[model samples]
Target: MKTVILVALLLLLFPIPVLGGESGLVISSYSVNPSTLFPGDTGKLVVTVTNTGTRSAEIREAVLYGNGLKVLSPGYSKLGTLTSGGSVDLTFVISGMKEGVYYPTLVVRGNDSTLQYPILVTVDSTEPEVLLDTGILYVNEVNRINFTIINPRSGDLTSIKVRPIVDGNVYPEYLYFDRISGGSSAKGVFYLYTTKPVETVQFSLQFNNGENVRYTNTTAPINSLPSREIQISLEKYPNEVLRYDTVVFSGNITNLRQDTIYSLIMSIEGDGIVSSRDVVLPALSSMDSVPFTIRVTPISSGTKHLTLTYMYSDVLGKIYTGSTDLYIQVPDKDVLSLNGVEIKKDGIELNIIGDVSNLGNYEVKGVTVSVLASDSEESYFIGALAPSDFNSFDINIPVKENTSTITISIQFVTGVGQLITIQQNLPVKEKPVLKEPEIPKKYYILIGLISVLVLVVVGYSWKRAMQ
Candidate 1:
């Protein structure tokens, strides 16, 4: 009875082999050649079928079906027989229509059994399209290379590197983008300078597709123009100014091109002067000109330099910056002066005659003149004088012995009503003495008495002779 029970347990555990072919068919393994496909990208799906049972399996046909996936080749693979523990590979070339996850089914029909399996496929379909927006690139200067990257599909791109390569070295050679979603765009810039000229350059785009890296290159021609495109000229009123005087600065801005410039902005800056200021302009058309003016007062005397910066953009979103310089000279302030002077000298006396005039653009009031000689001083009063007008003045100065020079000071109030003193030096010379015949102090009285006596004698002698 124990032996019978052991036989029955063995029979239950392991079933006896069938007389006809005992077969089993299963999908052992499947793989995607590239594992991922971009939209319109072609790839292959490989399915491996195996007979796992003890007998051989005959496969009549196998078919793959999915949505948005077009099979390049015939959709089925035929296999005559699959031996026991043997595997067969079925390849299906397919192209993806758009980006998304897809689940494909693989059905295998055999003589003994039928099997259905699910296959996983991913269509990345996200491609990066890079473009250069800058039109000109100059050497030995900070030239901006503007670029844009666009993702056109519905999938996301990751680990993107945009690199600019040229004949010479480029500053900030590359830019990185961690992740870019579908239907999105990003902008970047690279600054480059070269000692020599370069004609062409290449920009490379690198990004990750699943587990692989992809590279794409684009070539562009460099078209550089002169940096100073806008014509600017500065005009200063009273080009030569005096210290502490207010001056007017004027200028004109003209467009030198035949195209329209948008968002035109200008700024003014100077050294040792006021802070920066900006000028607003709406637009600039071809051959257009605009005038501007500013007033400034200088405390010290010297040359002043001004810089005008112009920033504008073109229709294609290209930016251009240019600059121009202006110079102004400042002179020292002038004092009141005397013109058309005449001097006459006599014995211990001097005469001075001159015209007092205002040469500058200022009024002078309370005018007075003083003469100092031999430590003695004298003053003369004159009235107010207007600009470009003159007045005459005369003065008699007394000089002492050994006095060779005299000082003349003129006092007045300036245009701004400020007290001022102006002075001039006048030379002095003494008149020489003349020598005459010497005569006694009483000679005129003695001569008169002699003449009277002679007259009486003559009359008495005449009377005696008549008697």
Candidate 2:
């Protein structure tokens, strides 16, 4: 009986080991309400530690560790003494964690060993929304896209970046958000100017929590602008004249846009000549033509090219240029004239003389003299004459008794069919003899005979009278 009592007492003193909660500390229930939370969102974790052991266990403190995550509850409760089954409930609130899945470790310290529990916290962020004023902007025009960032959480947002994607390339300029007082929203403006028209533009908004949101829009088609149309025409004083002093250059312009053109410049350019002018043309329709004129003084003789350039504007306040070309001809000046003529006779030689003058600005070539007889069928040709000089030629004529009157015609002929004519008359007469013709012999003899007969008869009569 003593051995049985001793064995029973010893077996009662040493208890058998149990699988759970030998130290009188147990986690009855634990849960985290909303395991996933965003930045600036409030969340809660509930933990129940129970004492199920036979002896009492002193609870020291509980701690949680993670960046920007903290425990709301402070100090560990001391359940100084507990019977077989006893429990304590603990609650914790955490705030201010970025977007990510995080493992938060909760440590419970006791007199024996430290216990750690990993709590999973998931942070989800909302993407921002962006709005654009115009999806398509014309060249050299302003592009303004508005942005709105909505934050549903309770914390203040720090920095935000907006990037524009053009043709699959990121634009280097970043847009920033403006602070909103007493609100969880941010508004920003993105202004851009482009010289080239874009087909599509995409924008991305990045928050401080490393979350990105993208938006895209298509631009509208750009309208055609107003441009200058220049038409050139050439006018002259006499159309058939090979040479002229001045030529008139006429141009027409049509402004196809609704806006008036200011300081519209027109220029004419050609070989060795240039002219320009500026004028203002009111807004005119495509059918309306505005006329403009410029005087062109010819410098030399040849074909001259005339180019016209004009400027105009479009509806979008853009400028355009147009040009046209034309041609003109200038003739040369004249420089030759004809002078008088003279006639002289030496024995049987007939000499003709004339004068020539240089009436032109330039020298003359291939000058000659031609003579035609009025009484006979004979013609004569003279040699070339120098400029501003006179030439004479002696022509021998075969004289016949039947040739009573001689008509002399003189002409100064240039090789190019320019001729001058002069005519004169010459009379023919007989030559005088040196000695007197012999007197008639019959008359002289008769006179002598008569005188002798008279003398004889007078002598015979006197003798007879005397006897």
Candidate 3:
């Protein structure tokens, strides 16, 4: 008895182990469509049965039974034989009648054994999400609104479609997407034309849970902005321009509206004699200002017409253009003139002296005068002559006896830094010819004869007066 008791205790402590073969027709993987369900909504439950054993297994029936989650399809029967390491799919249609959580049992019966597995199913009646974003919409033009449909379930959604519900104008009334994985999101887009003070925009999304069709909607407010005029003024510009006056038309371009300006450009086209180049400022934000300058050079004198043109576009793809006209009168007067000119001949040289005056309204820099005589050339420098100002210049150039005309050139730099030279021909003065004191050729004898005659007449008149 003691030996049997010891053997029993020993056997209880360390029992003998029995090893068997691997399992066949196991429930390898299972999934419920739209893993979360809604009341009265139908879905699917797919179970993958694999033959992981050394030999094939014959599947007799694959069925599902539960109290809360209702099964609409009958059991899968006579599924044939599954080869070793091969697999087959078992699908069942299921639904929920009320909002609650349910545990359903999957019973797989094979020729060798029977197995039962419980799957947790949910029926919370939670709806999917539809998000709408109207990103930077402009008034009275084509705009885009984005829609993001999110699936909060554990299974994927199918045949998803979104519709933009707007009472106003829009294109392609609806947008379609094929599918959205469970717990993931999908995107959709719609183009709409909106006006200022836009109305509320709404959206509706419809999809399938592999069994029944479901819907989700949203009512989002649509926002839009209007275009305000850009402020432009000629802040620092000359009202009149000289023949070669390079005047800068500087102004401040301000964005008074609530949107950024795009591709802003200012131009002064080549209008006959008035010419300029283009100035550009790509973008300007709201309430921001940018200063610009355009250099103008006029080549001719007239009632010249110029325009300071500006152009830009908005986010709505509409181009806005404006112009500020400028009228400048260029007088037909010589820029430099000579005053108080005097010429004299001294021996074999000619002296030329004058005051060089700037007649235009602009200053002339680096002024000089040159004289070309018959036998020689001369030059004088009179630097930096302001408008209506004068400077003296004198030149002594060698000349021949027969020299009659001489050339005078006035050279200077314009206010805009241009070298200019003007030439004029002047007649040289000749020396006065003098004869040795006029010999009274018989003139002295005739004067003595006149004096004798006057004396005789005076003697006769005196004798008569004495008598």
Write candidate 3's Cα lDDT for 32-61 as tens digits: 776777788887888777777778778888
List candidate 1 segments past 4 Å from native. Answer: 1-115, 118-127, 137-144, 152-154, 166-173, 182-184, 191-201, 229-232, 236-336, 340-402, 408-424, 428-467
Give the local distance difference test score of model 2: 0.51
User: Distance (Å) between predicted and true CA of 135, model 3?
Assistant: 7.6
Q: After superposition, how far is residue 67 of candidate 2 from its true place, in Å?
A: 16
lDDT of 1 by residue, 117-194 (tens): 656667874457777788776544446678788877555567889888886556687899997776788888877655
**Ranking by TM-score, best first?**
3, 1, 2
Deviation of model 1 at 399, angstroms? 6.6
Q: Per-residue alpha-carbon lDDT of model 2 for 1-467, expressed as tens digits?
A: 45644553443344222223357565556655544455666667676766667777666776676544655555454535434577677677766457765556566666674555555555666444444544444344334445455555433444555676553222246776643222367665555445555665566655443221223232322232222233444343333112213344655665433333444666666774333244456555544567877644444456766676667554334566777666766555322233444444445444445444444222224444344443333445544544444444444454444544565554544322334354555554434456888889998999999999999999999999999
TM-score of each: 0.42, 0.31, 0.56
User: How do these models rank on lDDT, best leading?
Assistant: 3, 1, 2
Candidate 2's TM-score reads: 0.31
Q: Check candidate 1 and list the clashing pairs.
A: 39-125
Weakest 10 consecutive residues of candidate 2 by summed lDDT: 237-246
User: After superposition, which runs of candidate 2 have C-alpha atoms over 4 Å from their true positions?
Assistant: 1-124, 139-156, 168-172, 178-197, 209-268, 277-467
Best by TM-score: 3
Give the Cα-based TM-score of candidate 1 against the true structure: 0.42
User: Any residue pairs clashing in model 2, and if so which?
Assistant: 226-314, 243-331, 335-360
Evaluation by lDDT, superior candidate among 1 and 3? 3
